[model samples]
Target chain A: MKPIIEITDLYFSYDNKNLAINNLNLIIYEKEWVAILGHNGSGKSTLAKLLIGLLEPLRGTIKVNDKILSQETVYDIRRETGIVFQNPDNQFVGSTVADDIAFGMENQQISREEMKKRIDKYIKKVRMEAYLQHEPHLLSGGQKQRVAIAGALAMDTKVLVFDEATSMLDPQGREDINTLIQELKNDGDKTIISITHDIKEAMLADRVVVMKEGTVVATGKPTEILKDETLMKDCGLDVPLTVKLSQELKKYNIINDIYVNQEDLVKSLWEYSLIK
Target chain B: MGIQFDKVNYLYARGTSQEKAALIDIDLNIDLNDFIAIIGHTGSGKSTLIQHMNAILQPTSGVVKILDKTIIGGRKNRDINIVRKRVGLVFQFPEYQLFEETVEKDIMFGPLNFGVTKEESAIKAREALKWVGLDQDLLQRSPLNLSGGQMRRVAIAGILAMEPDVLVLDEPIAGLDPQGQKEMMEMFYNLHVNQQKTIILVTHDMNYVAQYANRIIVLNEGRIGFDGNTWDLFANYELIKKYHLDLPDITKLIIDIENKLGIELDHKINTVENLAQALVQALGGANHVR
Candidate 1:
């Protein structure tokens, strides 16, 4: 399968003194939910910006969908990609939820009728249909992020980047967005890249890329990466609670398998207990 | 004495078409040296409740007594700065409030505002910087030039420099990386421990509430849903769910294990280590494991 997005030898710096992304190389395939996990200054967000042409790489190249990203092709690249940032208030440009969802479509000069159709479709996708007329300020942080996701989807972008989009939300809100992401992934075809420090969120992804100091430290399946305690610690991340509990129980010879979810872990424990 | 709120009711744009009640019949008593965690859904009056601690927002129909000062509703309180100085609030995303050119100047601003001497305020700023774990060299640099985490530390230090007896934090660790969040929580934990200061934290993370706070308060739709000890808060899962709150992961795991296995397990496990031990014991102890 062709890689949906290919980044090679990517180097970027905010100032000449510090390289925000240093000699990073990454490949994301079609319909893959890739989670980029790292600490605050680990260049994960910088990679997101570089992917959408918000920040230009000092060296190397980024290719999206077989086309090399350049100054001339940047707008086209952005049209194919949409990003939701950390703060919901900063990204909201419209007064109402419907207006916000329609803002991106209006920018593309989409017709009013077409815009209405996309807005209705995507707003329902994020489960914010009841809040179609609600203003941005009145909505909860999670609802605002849902509206932001709707706005992104209304653009019909194939590749969506969520840059710590759930960081500011409450636990319930985080769960809501995560469930929405799962639904989107189940629908398939779109490439999703989430840049976050949330271990549980990363555990749901198809691939987890751990970063450190602007470089890729490890990239593997979520289960594989999360099991490497030394690596997770080096990258300044906490292992998921279920994984940690499983490991601890394994030390006492109670549960042999490393489980990432609660139900499976409990089932394994029950089986072990019955055997004893 | 710390702070008390009696029948507090706060209305946004009161007596107008847009009037909305933010807090309804809030009666809370926060004792000195208390570590209290407030849990609620977004727009559940957490922010509005904490603002009353430092007189940032006065109640529409209540009496707020901070230390010895009494602020009555429907009356202008001219001496509220005394209450503000006694309760230092670290607002959410406080880094955005950093406006001073240098980090040191910004830290000193709060103490200086409260009538501390220039030299004393500088001393307090240095002490505050140390408390937040920032290096002394960064004091001269522009606060805007610092990293996001560092800027947050500086903002927190600005509040600490005020030497308030009570610290009210509104989601201070929001938007921080995992390591940053841990470090910030630890810093506050130390402050609560060593300084013996009252900590009133409004947060959405149940894990932090279970681990740190001795007392937990839940709010729902501008009303106090539940207020009790951390242990009771976790055990009251039904009430927790009703208020749109969740049990911490460790507690949830234990509950799940019990439900799946059709066996009763203790739900008092607050930490991962405790949960691991409890699971092993529930499976008939370590010796029984083949």
Candidate 2:
């Protein structure tokens, strides 16, 4: 089985003085949901840019779908990968929501009818069909992100990368995006990579890759990695609020599973009561 | 030092074709020395409310009274500087606001703007740097050269150097990693506790409010959804759901367990330790009853 993403001894630097990324190595399987966790300037974003071909690696190679990443092949790799940035406002090139989604298909020289159908399709998928005619700047943060996602999804890219996409969203919006990402993973087709600060979101990913300074320090299942208090603290993150509450409820054995989501915790507590 | 919002109303892009009413008829008061946390969805008027506190924005209607004087009562062309000096606001991703060549100069900009001499501002800049846990040695270094976390701290020190009576930070830890978030939270806590400054933190992260804030204010559709302690907010599970916000996972777990097994676990758990103790007590009680 071939990995969807393969990075070996990949090094990146913005300037001669500071190497933004150390000799990092990573491999992501196809159809897997992976989250790269790190604080700002931890080089996760830089890593994301490198994967998408926005930034060239100073040393080493990145192979996506067995194609070695280089300046020449980057544009081709980008055709298969779609990235949504942290600031939705900066990513939008079209004035209206619909126009933004169509921009990708237009660049790909997709047929007019096919383009129109996809624009209609993804806009409704993100529940932003009503705002298709609205200007990007006029929308709220969540709405802008929804549009950004619509644009990305419309591209029909095999690999979807969200770079702190939910940071700008509110709680409800963040949850909505989380649910959407989970739904995408449920399809078991598209490979998903989300670089995020929210530990809860990381927990939802199949694997959480913790980055510090510029290299991958630890990578494992969310359940296993999230429990490490020292690693979490050192990474500039705190446990999910639900995890903390579950820890509190451990005395009663009410909330059984130590999870990142409060809803699961609540359901477990309810079940525990019935069995007891 | 208390800030009062007296039936304030504000509109975004007012008098323009795209205008939207963002804040509506807000009436609340925050006492001095309080660690107040505002939790709201984006565009819920939380930002509009905070902008009114320091007269950075004037209410389209109603009044904002900070330190007993109406924020909009004074002439905009005169004496507004005093109001700005009294309330130091750190906007989201505040690192973007840093522009000085060096950390020391950046921190001193606030005090120097208010007429502090160069030498005095340097001393105050050092004090502020110390307050945020930065070393004096980094003073001359360009703020751009510092780490992202350090750059943020430098931006905050600039605010602290102003020595504002009330410090307002909007989404201060929006995208930071766990460690940086903890350090920033501790810095805010220390500033409020050890330094005796009042704080108003606008955040979506309820964990911060649950762990630190003395009071929590919820905003929904430009109105006060709830204003109470963390315990009160968590206890009313329905409101949490209605607002479309998830309960901290642990609380949900306890509630779920209670529903499934019919056990009485503590409903007021906030931290991991509290939930753990509550779980033990409830289990013990259930065993005794059995």
Per-prediction interface RMSD in Å: 1.7, 4.4
lDDT of 2 by residue, B1-290 (tens): 58888888888887899998888889899998999988877767888888888888887888788785675522353466787787999988788888989899999999999999999999999999999999899999999888778988999999899989899999888766667778889999999999888999998777677788888889999999999887788888789888866565556666766776566767776656765666656655323332
For model 1, what is the error of residue B51's alpha carbon versus the real structure, in angstroms, after optimal superposition?
0.9
Judged by lDDT against the true structure, how good is candidate 2?
A: 0.83
Fnat per candidate, as a fraction, reads 0.73, 0.70
Chain B TM-score for candidate 2: 0.93
* Lowest summed lDDT window (length 10), candidate 1 chain B: B281-290
Judged by whole-model lDDT over C-alpha atoms, candidate 1 comes out at: 0.89
- Model 2: residues with Cα > 4 Å off, grouped in runs: A230-276, B11-21, B72-77, B238-246, B285-290
Clashing pairs in 1: none
Q: Give the per-residue lDDT digits (tens) of candidate 1, residues A17-116.
A: 8899999988999999999999999998889898999889999999998888999999888888999999988998888889988998888999999999
Q: Write the per-residue lDDT of candidate 2 for residues A104-206, one digit (tens) a residue.
A: 8898899999989999988888888899899999887778888898899988988999999998777877877888889889977799999998777888899
